[model samples]
Target: MKTLEHIPLNGELPSPKGVALAILELCRKDDATIAEVARIAQTDPALASRLIRQANSAAHGGGRPVASVTEAIMRLGMGTVRNLALGFSLVDQYQNGPCGQFDYQGFWSHSLLMGLAMQKFSNMTGAGASEELFACGLLAQVGRLSLATVYPVEYGRLLDGQDGVARNLVALEQEHLQTDHNELTAALLGEWGIPGALIEPIYHHEEPEHSGFSTGSRPYQLVHLFYLARRVADLGLAGENERNACTAELLLLGGRIGLDAEQLGATVDDLVQQWRTWGELLRVPASALPSFAHMSAAHAMRDEKSDGAAALRVLLVDDDPTTRCMMEGVLSGALGHAVVCANNGREALALAVETQPQIVVTDWMMPGMDGLDLARALRATEWGQTMYLIMLTGHENEDEVSEAFEAGVDDFLVKPVNVRTLRARLRAARHYVQLLEAWERDRAQLKQFAAELAISNRRLAHAAMTDLLTNLPNRRSGMNALAKAWAASSRFEQPLSVMMLDIDHFKRINDSHGHAVGDTVLRDVAQAIQQSARKDDSMCRMGGEEFLVICPNTDLKAAVQAAERLRRMVERLRIQAGETEIQTSVSIGVATREVGMTETDALVNAADRALYRAKQAGRNRSCVVVQGQMRCFP
Candidate 1:
C-alpha cells in the first residue's frame, strides 16, 4: 500500500464529509472511544438513524434492535462503523461528480450490489463479519471514483476514447493518468485504517488470477469472493443482453468456489433483494433484474436444441456390484451418457482426476471413501470443484441428508435408485453442464469485464459442445464405460475385457520407507498409469495399490498386449527418492467377457481372482483367466 504521502494526487481524494468526517476524525485519535465516535455520529440525524437501523438489520440484529447511536456503534464494531461512514459520506457528496463520461449513479448502484453480494456470500461461507465485508464491498472500487473526482476532465476523456476495443481499464487509466483506481482505492482504504487483509483482495479483485495467493487459502477465497461479488454487481447493472452475455462466466466463478447453479441463483436473488433495501437506505439507485435462472435460460435457450444431443461423461460410484450395474444401465443405456464406475470413493477420486466427468453419482455408504467424503474431496479440487455430485443413499434420515448437502453433495438419490428421480435430478445437472459448456465455448468472445461502457459489445457465437477437458489423470463416471462397452460388444458381437493392476508389495514399501517416500512413489506410479493408458481404456483405482482398467472392443490377446505395455511402463519407472531411486512394479490380472456372460460383475470378479493369482504366482507378473482355464505370463 502506497502511503498517502506518495500517491501524487493533485485534487482532493474522496473522503467522508460532515458527520462522517467528524466520526472519522474522532475515531482516528488514539484516546478516542466508541462513545466519542457515537457522540459525533449522533449530531447527524440521518447518519445516526442509518447506523442504528443497520445494527438491527437481519445480519446484525438478533435480540432487541439497537435504539441509540452508541448501541449501534458498539454492536457493529468501531471498524465497520467507520468504514460505513466513509462509504455513505462519499455517496452523499459524490452523487453527481464532474466527470461527464462517468455514470455516478450507476457506480453507486453497482457498488451497492457488490456490497450486498459480498455480505451475502460472507454469511453463506463464514468468510468474515457481514457488516465489515458489506462495507468493504461497497467501497471496493472507490478508487475509480477517486480518479473521477481528482481528474474529471482527463478521466472522462480517457473513458470516451476507448471506442470499444476492450482494453483493460487499469492500463487505460495509467496510460492517461499516472495512477489507477486500484492503487488509489487501496491507499484510501489504508488511510482510513481498513485492515490490509481486506484491502489486498479488493486491490486484486479485478483480476484475482494475478493475486498469487495459494489455492484454497483464505486470501484466495476472499479475492475470488470479491471477484464474484463484482460479477453480481456487474449483472445487477447490466442491460439484458449484457446480463445474458455474462451469466455463464458468473456461474463458473461461483462454481469454482463450490456453489452449484441452483445455490448461486438463490444467493443472487437474496442479495438483489438486500441490494434494494440497502439502496433505499443509502439513497443510491437500484433496479429490478430478472432471476438468475431466467438469465441463464435466456442465454442458453437458443442452443437448447443441442443440449441433450451429446453424450455426457458421467461418473457413478456404488459399493454394491448389483446397484452399480443397475445405475450404469440407467445412466448409460437409458440416458445416453458415457459412464465411468467406481466401487468405492477412493477409486472414484482417482478416476475423477483422469476422466473429468461432468456429473458424479455416488452411494452414500461405501467401505473406503463414503459418498459424502467423495463429494467433499471432489469439491476441494480445482477441476472437480464443479462436477455435479449426487448422493445415492438408502437412509432417509433428514439430518443425514442435510449433512450430505453441507458436505457439498449437489443432489442425492434415495434407495432402490428410482430411475425417474435420478433422471429428474440429472436433468437439472444436465442443464447446469450445458450452461457450463456454453461458457467454455463463448469465453473467448466475451470481454474481460463488463463494468464500463467502453467494454466491447461483440456478438457471441452460437454454442457448441466441445468435450469438457481438464488436466485429466480421468472420472468415477458410472459403469457407463463398461455398459457402453457392453452395448458396443453386444451390438457388434465383439470381444470385451477388463484388467486389474496391483502395485506389488506396496505395504512393504510403506513399511520399509516413511509414508512420504511411499506417497511420492504412489503419485509417480499414478502418473505413469495415466501416461501408459490408451484413450479407449477406462482406468480407475479399485482400492489401495490396486486399479481397474476396462478394455473395450479388445480380445484376450489384444487386452494382454495392452496390459504388457502398461506393465513395462510401470517397471521402467525409477521414482526418485531423497537419496535413492525407488523402483516399483505392478502385478496384472486380465479377464475377458466370455460368451453367455450376462453379469458385468462376473468380468470384474474374474479380474480380481486373476489378480490374486498374479500375486500368488510371485509378484510382478501377469495372469489371464479365460472361461474356466487360466494362463500365466511372467
Candidate 2:
C-alpha cells in the first residue's frame, strides 16, 4: 500500500560494490565499449576470472574458451558481464548479513532455482534474453532481503509467525511494514539500473491476475513465468503432497502459456538440471528436485480422461423402477456417463443441485412434480440453465411436445425409447458441448494475442527512443526526461542543472585512426563520463561524441563541480584503439535553472553556450554560467 520511497533501505539495498559498481556504471552508458568494460573487470582478478568462466560456461557455449577478460567481454557482451559482476558481488557482500529471520543459504538456493527456471523458460518461450532473465529471477525476491535489512527485529517477528498457511508473508508485511517485498524489489532493481521492462513484472508478480497487466502482455507473461518458477522451486523443495499440487499447477500454467504437457515436462527437467549446475557454481545447497516426467505420468494414471471422458454427469429420473434401471444402464454403460437416478421429479430436482449433472432424462407422466414442472424449476436457476434436458413420453402428441419445449425440454423420447435415436441425440449434445469449449479457448487465445501485440508495440516505441550504440537514452529521450524534470522542478521550486560535454579533438581522432577506432574511442569516452556521473543524473548521448547530463535539485556550483569531475575522468581515459594507446579529454559546460528559467530547451541552450566557452578556453575544462556570466574552470 505504501510506496518504496517511504520505506528506509538504510542506503544499502544489496547493490554491487567496488569493481562491480564500476562495471555496472560503464555498462549503463549507451556508448560503452567492450574494451573499456574488460579493462575495469581486469582490475579485480576475482571479477575477471568470473567473467571468463561465465563466458565459457556451458550455458554460453558458442565459440572457443575465453582466456582473457577482453575475450570474455567480447563473447558475453556488456550487459551479461554487468549482471554477472553484480550477482557475484552481491553474493560476496550478503552471504552473512544481520538478518536473523532470513534464511540466507535457503534464499540463494531458491533464488538459484528461480533464476535457472526463468532462463530455461525464456529459452523455450523466446520471451526475452536468457542472460538478463537469470539476474531478474535471482533478484526477484530481493525486496524480502531489503525488509529484513531495514527492520530486522520487526521482520524477524513477522517471519517467526509466517506459517505460510495462516498468514501470507506479503500480507503480514503490508500490515506491519506498510510495504511488501514486490514493491521493494522493483525499487531496488530500478535503483540498480535494471530496465523497466523487467522491473514492472517483478513489481506485480506477487498477485499478477490483479496487476493490471493484460493476460497475454509481455509483462503479464513474465509475471506468470516467475510464478511458475516459484511453484517449480516449491515443488522441488516441498514434501509429497505439496510437490504433487505444484506439479499439477505447473502443468496447467504451462498450458496457458502455450506449452504442451510434453514441452512443459521437458522444460522442468532442463530447469532442474541447470539449477543443480548453478547451485554448485554459486555454492548454494540444491536438493533433488521432483521429476516432472515421473510425477506427471503418475498423476496422469491417477486422473486419466477416457475417450468418452469422466466429465459427463447424467441424471436419470423415472417413477417406474424398471424404466429407471434400463435408462441408467444405457447412459452409464453405452454413453460412458456417471449416472444418478431419482424415483420422481421432486427427488430429481434435489439431486440436480447435489450431483450437478450435465444431462437430465425424465419421464413426462410422474406421480408428483412431473417432468415439465422439474424442467421449469431447473431452468429458473443459474447452474441448470445450461444443462441439456430430455422428456420421455408414452405417445407423441403435438400439443404435448409444444408444452414440453416451452418448459425447456431439448428433445422428446416417445414410448420405449429407440436406442439408436437416443444415441444420435446424445452425439448432438456432445457436439454442442465441444463448440462451447472451443469458443472459450478461442476467446482466451484472442486476449493473449492482443496483449502480446500491445507489449511488442511498447518495446518498439522504447527502442526508437534509445540509442543503439551506447544503449543510453537518445536525444529525444533526453529531451523528454528533461521536460519531465523541468515540470517537477517548477512545481517543487527546486534547482535543475544541465551539463553539455564534447570529447576534445574527436574529428582529428576519426581522421587519424580511421572511423572504426574513432567509434571505439567515442564508446570509451561515453562510458568514462557516465561512470563519473551521480545517481540522480540523467545521462544521454546527444549525437556524435556529445553527451548531456541532467541533474535535478542541483545548484550552479555543484553542477560545475560535477562537470569538472567528469572532464578529469574523461581526461584520464587511456583507450586502446587497436595497437595504439589513444588518450582523450572532454570540454564540459554547466548551467543551472534560475527563478525566471521556464523552458528546458532554453536551459540546454545555455549549457551549450557554456560548453562552447569551455572549448574556446582550451579543451579539458569546465565552464559554468553564474548570473548570466561565463566562468571557466581549468
Candidate 3:
C-alpha cells in the first residue's frame, strides 16, 4: 500500500476548491457556527441545494423539507453538511477530466446506492449512526476516483484488468501503481477530520472478516455492513449472472447479521425505491431492481445456463487412473470444458506449461512431486502466476491447509470429494477464467484508445500554438520564445534584439477593395517577412497587420540592418487580389536589450515606440532606438 506521501499533493485528488475550500477553512475553527457553514454553502447555490436535498433524503430519514441552507445545516449537523458540500463541490468540478477509464456517471450511481444501503442496513441492524454511515458509504469508493485523476492514462489500464483473475483490486493496484485505494481513502478521510469510527470500518471494508477487530465489535460489524452495501450496489448495477452472484453473496452476508432471507429481501426492495428518488435528486443514474427474493428466483432459472460453457482448458492430475477418470468425467460433463488428464504431478506440470490451461486440479499426495510442489513450481513462472490451482487433499490438518495456500492453491477439496462440492468449485473457477479473458480483451482495446488519445492531444497542442491564417507562431508562443531568449542572453551576457513591423496604410486596402484583399496582403507580407528573416530569427503574427521578429545574440547595428532588409523586401512585394494589383510597404522599429533594461516587456515597448517614430517620419522606413533615442534609417 502507498503512504500519504505517495499521493500527489499537486491537485491530483479531489480536495476542496472554491466554496468548498472556504467551508473547510471555516470548519478548522472549533467555534464555527451553523450560520457560518450556511453562509459558505450559499456561496455556491447548486452545492447548497444538493446539501439540503441530501439532508432530507430517505438515507437521512425523510421529513419536513428544509427551505434554506441554515435549516439544512441545523438538521444534518455542521460536520455532515460540511462533508456533503465538499463531496458535491468535487463532483461538480471533476465530473469530466482526463480520466478516460473512469465512468463518472457510474461512480456517482454506485456511491449513491452504497450510501442508501449503508443507511438502511445500519437502521435495520442498529450497527452505527445512520447519518454518519450514509456519508461513509457515499465516499467509500472516492479513493478509486482519486487514483484515476492522478494517473489517468495508467489507471485506465489498471481498471481494465479489474475483472481479471486478481479478484483483490487493492492487490492489483499495489502491484501496478505501488498504491492501493484503501490506504488512500483512509488517509483522505483522516485529513478531512472524519471520526475514526467511520474511517476504520471503510479502511477494512474490503476484507471485513480478516480485520483485526473482534467479530462482534462495532468496527467489525460496520465493516461487514459496508461490504454488504458494496454487494448491494453491485447487484443494483449488475445484469444476468453477475446480478445472481451478487444476490447469492448478499443472502449469505445478511444471514451473518441475523436478518432472515425474507426480511432482507423486503428491506432491499424499499431501499431501491428510495434510491431511485435520491438518484434523481443527485442527478446520478439508478436502475430499478426487483426484490432480492425475485433476483434469487432469477438465479435459479439461470443456474443451468451458467454452467453451459465454462470455455476454460482444465488440467486434471491424480496418481490413480480411476480417480483421474472420475474427476475428468464430472468437470468436462458439467462445464463442457476440454479436459487433459495426467496420472502424475511431473507430467501435469509439463502439460500445464505446454497447453497453458486456465485451471489445474491435482491430488495432494502424488508420487515424485506432490501437489504443493507442483503449485509452488508453477507459481514461480510467468504464465502460472494467474493460473487457478486447486489442491485435493484428505488431510484436514490446519497447518497443511495453510501450507497449501502458501504454495498458491486457490481452494482445497477434501478427498472422496462430494460431487456437488467439486462441481460448485469448478463453476467458481470458470467464472474467474472468463473474467481473465475479458480483462485481456479490454486491455487490448484500452491500449488502442490511449494511442488515439495521445495523437489527438498533440494535434490540439499544435493548434493552440500556431496561428491558423499564416501557419506561424501566434503572439503567445512568440512571447514565450522571447522570454526564453531573454534568459539565455542574460546568462551569456549577449544582446537580444526585437523588431515590430506594421503594414503602412493597410486599412485603405481593406476599406477600398474589401477585407478579402486585406487578408491577401497580410498573407503575402507574412510570407515575404519569413523569406527575409535569418535562420536564427523567430517570426510571429501579433494580430492583424502587425508582426514581430526576434533575433537572439544580435546587437543594435545588426538588428537595424535586418529590419531595413525586411522593409525593402515588403516595398518590392506585390499581391494580386480579385483583378486588383496591390502594392504595399511596411514601417519597421528595432530595439535591443542593453545594460539598463531588466525585462523582456521593456524591450518590446521600446521597439513599439521606435515603430511609431518610423511611421511619423515616413510610412515606409525603419527606425532604430539607441541609448533611449529613436534614429530614422532611410
Candidate 4:
C-alpha cells in the first residue's frame, strides 16, 4: 500500500546497482522484450549465472535446462527477471554493511533459505511463479537490511538490546528509527513496481490476522504463505537448541496447507539442500542443519514422554555387515526403537512385507534390487505408500539426490553419516509415525460420528457437481451433461455437438500481471461464454484456461457458427484489474456426433483433437473435424 513517496527515511535506502540497475531501467519500457533483458543480463556474469541457475531450478525448469541467457530470460519472463535482478542487486551490495549487531552473513543465509522454501511452497500450492516467489522470499526482509545499512550504529544498538523476548520490533523501530521495517519494505517493493496486491500481503504477513483479507482470497493465502516461509526460514537459521521450539509452530503452519509430518519434513529437507547450493553460488554461509523430521520428532518425544508412544519398527537394509550391525545397535540400543536388519535389497523386500515396518532405512548400491528399486517396489504396494523411507547414499550431487527422492525415498543421508544427524532424521520418522497413529484414531472417531450426517448429502452433492470459482459446471458435471445430451440425441435422432475452447497465451497474462488478474479474466470469460450460450447448450470450466460447451440439437454447421460467435465474444472482452485492462482471445475446436459415433468419448475426443488443430493453426479462431476433414475458421 505504501510506496517510496510515502515512506520517510533519514538516509539513502538500498537500491539496485550495476547491470541490475540497467536491466531494471530497460524493463520499465512498455515494449520491453526478453531479448533486451537477456542482453543486459549478459553484461553481468554473476547475474547471468544466477538467471541460468534459476531457470533450471527444479520448480521452474521442467523438461530441459536453458543454456543461454536469452532462453533463461524467456523461461523466467521479463517481470520475474527484473524483480530477481533487484533482489540480487540488494544482496550483492548489503552482504556486509556497516551494522555491527546485525548478523549480515546469517541474514543472507536465512534469506536464501527462505527464498528456496518459498519456491518449494509455490510448487506445492501453485500459488504463483516459483521463481518470482523465490525473489520475493529473498527480499522479504530487505527492510531490516536497509535499516542496518542506513543507520548502522543506531540499528546495531537497537538489535543488541533484543534479549530473546517476543516483542513487536516494528513498534520499537517506530520509537527509535521513526520508520519500521514493514512500512519501508512495502514502500521499497511498491517503488520497484511490485503489484499492490502482493505488496499488501507482504506488508501484513507478519500480522496476517489483522490483514482483514477475505478467508479464501488470493492475498489471504499469499500473506499466510509469506508467514510460513518466514517461520521456516527462522527455523533453518536458528541455533540447534532453538530449532526444536520453532518446529512445533512450523508443523501447525504446514498442517494448514495439508502437509503431514513426514511430507513436510521431506519437503523442508529438499529445500535446505538447495539452500546450501545457492549459498555456494552467492558466497553466503548456509549452515548444515538436521532434517526437519529430526527436530519435529525431538519435540514430540519431549511432549509425549508420559503418553507411552510406541517404539518404531525400523527395517535397516545395508549390505555391509559392520554398517548394518552398527545401525541396528543404534536403533535398538540408543534410540530404543525395534530394529530389523537385512543384508541386501532382496532380503529387505522379503523382510519388509513380513514385518510391515513403520520405517525403512536402506542403503543404495545393493545386490539384485537396489535401494531405489526396493523403494519403488515398496511404494507400488498399498501398505508401503504410508511407510517412512530414508535412503543412505555416498553421492550428494543434485542428479543423484533427485534420483533417490524420485524413486520414492522420503529422505536420504550422506555416506558415513553423523550419528546426531541420523538420530535427528529418525526422530522425524518417529514423529511421522506418531502423527499417522493419531490421525487414524481421529479418523475412526470422526467416521463414527459422521455416520449420522446423511442429511447433508444434497448440499455436498451440489458442491461436488459445481465449479467453486466460476459457479459453472465442473469437468465431471460437463461430462455427465454431455452423456445425457448424447443419449437424447441417440433416442430422438437429433444432432449433438461440443466445443473445446482454450484461452490462448493465458500463462503470459498471469506472468505479466498476477494470478489475481488471471482469476478476474477467467471469471469474466466464463460469464461471457455462459450468457451467450444457446438455451439448450451447457457450459463448464473444464480447468485452467480451458472450457467445454455442449450444444444439443445443433448440427456441425450450427456448432461452427456458435464457436465463431463465442470466439468473437471472448476477443471483445476487456477485463479490468486494478489499473490494467486485459483482453484475451480463445481458440475453439468443435465436433458434432456422427452416425458412426457410438460413445460420448469418441465425440469428446474428436472435439479435443480439433482443439489441438486450432491451437496448432495459431490460436484466436475455431477448427472442426467433419467426416474425416479438418477445417479452420479464421
Top candidate, metric lDDT: 4
Candidate 2 stretches with Cα past 4 Å from truth are 1-6, 10-13, 17-50, 57-67, 163-168, 214-221, 300-634
Q: What TM-score does prediction 2 earn?
A: 0.52
lDDT by residue (tens digit), candidate 3, 1-634: 3347766533557787988888878987999998988877888888888777767766555688888889988988888776776766666666666878789888888888898899888977888767767878988888888888887888888888787332477788888877777888888887887787888889888777678665356887899899999888888888765787888788888888788889889878887887798777667779987778888988866864665445678899999888888888888885577899998889998999799998899999989998999999999999998899989998789999999999999999998988889878877887788788779988997998799678767777887988888888899999999999999998999989999999999988899999878888888989998999999899899998989999999999999999999999998987897787888999999999977898999999999999999999987999988888889989
Each candidate structure's TM-score, on Cα atoms with residue i matched to residue i, is 0.50, 0.52, 0.48, 0.50
Candidate 2 per-residue C-alpha lDDT over 517-628 given as tens digits, one digit per residue, 9 for 90 to 100:
8888878877876798888889889999899999999988888888888888888889887789998898999999976776887899899999999999987899988778
- The stretch of ten residues in a row with the least summed lDDT in candidate 2 is 301-310
Q: What C-alpha lDDT do the candidate models reach, one value each?
A: 0.83, 0.82, 0.84, 0.87
Candidate 4 or 3, higher TM-score? 4
Candidate 1 lDDT over 1-634, as tens digits, reads 6767887787887888798888788778889898889888988888898888778877753778889999999999888898889888888888998899999999999998998888878877889998999899999989889888989999898888776322377789877787788988899899998999999999889888889775567888999999899889998988886886579898888887689999989988888888888788788999888899999998887545454724578988998999899889988888778999998999999999999999998998898788888999999888987799888888789999999999998887788877788778988998889778778766744553442213212211111111112212232432556778888888998899998889988888889887887777767766776778788877665546777788888999998988888888999989876787888999999999988789788888898889899889987888999876777786
What does candidate 4's lDDT look like per residue over 1-634, in tens digits?
A: 5567766677788999999899889999999988888888998999999999999888853768889999989888899999999988888887887888899999898889888888889789988888988988898888888898888888888887766432457777888987878888888888888778778888888878788776567898999998899888898878877887789988889998999988989988898889888899898888788888878888776876634324678899999998888888877887778888999888988999999999999999898889999999999999999999999998788998898889899899988878899989987887899889889998997896586355355556877999888889899999999999989998899999999999999999899999988888888889989977999899998899889999999999999999999999999999887887888999999999987899999998899999999999999989999986789998
What lDDT is obtained when candidate 3 is compared to the true structure?
Answer: 0.84
TM-score order, best first, reads 2, 4, 1, 3
- With a 3 Å backbone cut-off (N, CA, C), the pairs that clash in candidate 2 are 30-470, 30-471, 30-472, 31-470
Instruction: Give candidate 2's whole-model lDDT.
Output: 0.82
